[model samples]
Target: MTKPTLADLTAFSAVATHRSFRRAADALGVSRSSLSHAMLALERDLGVRLLNRTTRSVSPTEAGEALLARLAPVLRDLDDALDAVADARGNPSGTLRINANESAARLLLKTVVPLFLKRFPSMALDLVAEGRLVDIVERGFDAGVRLGESVPRDMVAVRISDDLRFVVVAAPSYLSGRTPLITPDDLRNHDCIRQRLPSGKRYRWEFRKHGEEMAIDVPGVLTLDHNGLMVEAASDGLGLAYVPESTARDWLDDGRLVTVLEDWCPFIPGLCLYYPGHRHVPAGLRAFIDVLREVNH
Candidate 1:
């Protein structure tokens, strides 16, 4: 057996992180063939297969998973140390990856993203918009943006937006001959457009009234995963949609969609930027946080 060089380890780490040779190569600014060769050499030296590669996808094997679990934190620490030095030299530069839902991404793009990029020209931001709550650390993200209540308690959360509210709305055409929705139970009689969560469960519509909270499992014929699509469906006269107030505002104001059960809608804590509490905050993340605070104010 031979000792693995730092390049070998780093390449292996990148491949394991992304589970794709091409993506890892792109991220590392190298050729896929070179990365594949490096992985082969690394595996030969270790005497164990680290990856299961097929024509369409790549994934870590048992040994690779073990190695990845150990390598991720150590590599992050090293990167942080380097970023710290860069910060001291007044040249903070690194990639800052963020996991956020569509609404959060929209909010950041509208308010904070431009300022943050202008302030930290050397830093690269990768914003992944997803519907599921993800493990930011495990996924190699610097942070995640989620609703305050949805953020993990173990992570440090910073408020990024003001309080948010949800609304149930439908186009006039759909509501024309339909029974009026006067209560939460009225949703049962109407054709609702439901949202599908990443976990494969349907998102139940939540409402609040006079200090009491209720979750309604509304039935619907169409199930969409994105909020934008839900709003579109509602506006197209397909069904009623329960979505964030911000998402439906334009449609509601223009009479493309009209709100229902507004009194039952509840104001909840807004989006937040959350990250691991134990690790050192990189300069890029710190800069982003500052911008978020500025925009929030």
Candidate 2:
């Protein structure tokens, strides 16, 4: 048994966290070959295979997962301690990674991002936007932004925006000949731009009014994954798009798109910035949260 250097252990954690040498190397600002060799040396020192590497992909072995589970908290504590010292000196400086769905990302970009960067000139933000809901802890993100209801129960959430509403919008040309749209069921008669969830399921158009609720798996000639794209399609008169009101706000205000079923689309919960409750919130993350509240209020 031999003691591995702190740097080697840190690199091992990064590789295990990402499950890809190239990704870990890029994040660590090292070459892939060097990272691979380092991982190999780490495994040899421990007398256990930590990662199962293939030509196409890499994954942590059972032992690697166990080590990572214990190592993550230790490394996080060290980071927090360092961040505290840095905070004592002045503005926090580090990269803050956030994973968010497209809608939430757009909201953050519009509201929190610019000010946070301007306020802390040394801080860097990596905002990854996609349709998928990822495990922020496992994926190595400082936080995640999603609608309040979608946040995992174990995490602490802070509201970043006002309550959001989803509305059905269409170009006037597309609405002209369509029958008066009233209820959720009426969508069947009109072409809609269907939204595809990251899980490969078509989103069921949900509506609530007068204590009645309905989820319609609306029919559509076109299916799109992103809300912004759906809004664009609807503006092109392709079909009705169900999207966040903010995403469609510009078009709605300029008369490029008109809303229908507004009564059925009542305000729901707003976007939230969430993170694991157990881990220490780094200085950069704390400062970032401050910016969110400042911009939000």
All candidates: CA RMSD in angstroms? 3.5, 2.8
For model 1, the superposed segments whose C-alpha errors exceed 4 Å read 1-3, 13-36, 45-77
lDDT of 2 by residue, 120-206 (tens): 998999888867888887677889999998999999999987898999999999988668997889999889999999999999999
Query: What C-alpha lDDT, on a 0 to 100 scale, does residue 260 get in candidate 1?
Result: 90
Cand. 1 Cα-lDDT = 0.88
Task: Report the Cα lDDT for residue 194, model 2.
Answer: 98
Best model per TM-score: 2
Q: Residue-wise lDDT of candidate 1 within 99-180, one digit each (tens)?
A: 9988889888999999988887898888889878977775668899999999999999999888999899999999897778
lDDT of predicted model 2: 0.90
Candidate 1 colliding pairs, count: 0
Model 1 TM-score relative to the real fold: 0.82
- Specify the poorest-scoring 10-residue window by lDDT in model 1: 20-29
